[model samples]
Target: MGSLDLEVTVYSRHSSNYHSYKGNIGTVNDNILNQKFNAKEPYTVIHTDIAQVKLSNGQWGYVSAVIDEANQEIIGTVVSS
Candidate 1:
């Protein structure tokens, strides 16, 4: 292969170091919900989450939302670039 001027493609694998700085930055709270998802009132139980999304311009953005457990509706939302 060397004499014929041909070379094989080599691939490499890498480990993720995204959480390298995870060193007691915040306190872990107790599981108050304990798998209970039902809520009698609108504001009694709420859930929040942040998600990363790919935009149309090939950029990354974050979407944060708060949901009401009783009606399963999104009470608040925010988008950040």
Candidate 2:
């Protein structure tokens, strides 16, 4: 059978320096797919912002997350303002 195709529906953010991570829609989807394919568990890769900071109206910054692929861990996240 083909890998399970799913999507992350929700996610949560912890305070700065917090050492915990709850998987989101994307992670969940990958998991299903991994099982179906019987491949190594999936993990999250670092994300690079595609949109420019100036894209926001009147906003000087943005919020972004950095996820670790191993163990599905969240490494660091920053919210720009």
Error of 1 at 49 (Å): 1.5
Error of 2 at 73 (Å): 1.0
**Candidate 1 off by > 4 Å:** 1-24
Error of 1 at 15 (Å): 13
Error of 1 at 19 (Å): 5.4
Instruction: Report the C-alpha displacement of residue 77, candidate 2, in angstroms.
Output: 0.7
Q: In candidate 2, which residue pairs get closer than 3 Å at backbone N, Cα or C atoms, i.e. clash?
A: 8-25, 8-26, 9-25, 62-80
lDDT of 1 at 2: 91
Runs of candidate 2 exceeding 4 Å displacement:
1-61
- Model 2: worst 10 consecutive residues (lDDT sum): 47-56
Q: How much is the lDDT of residue 45 in candidate 1?
A: 93
lDDT for model 2, please.
0.44
Q: How much lDDT does candidate 1 score?
A: 0.79
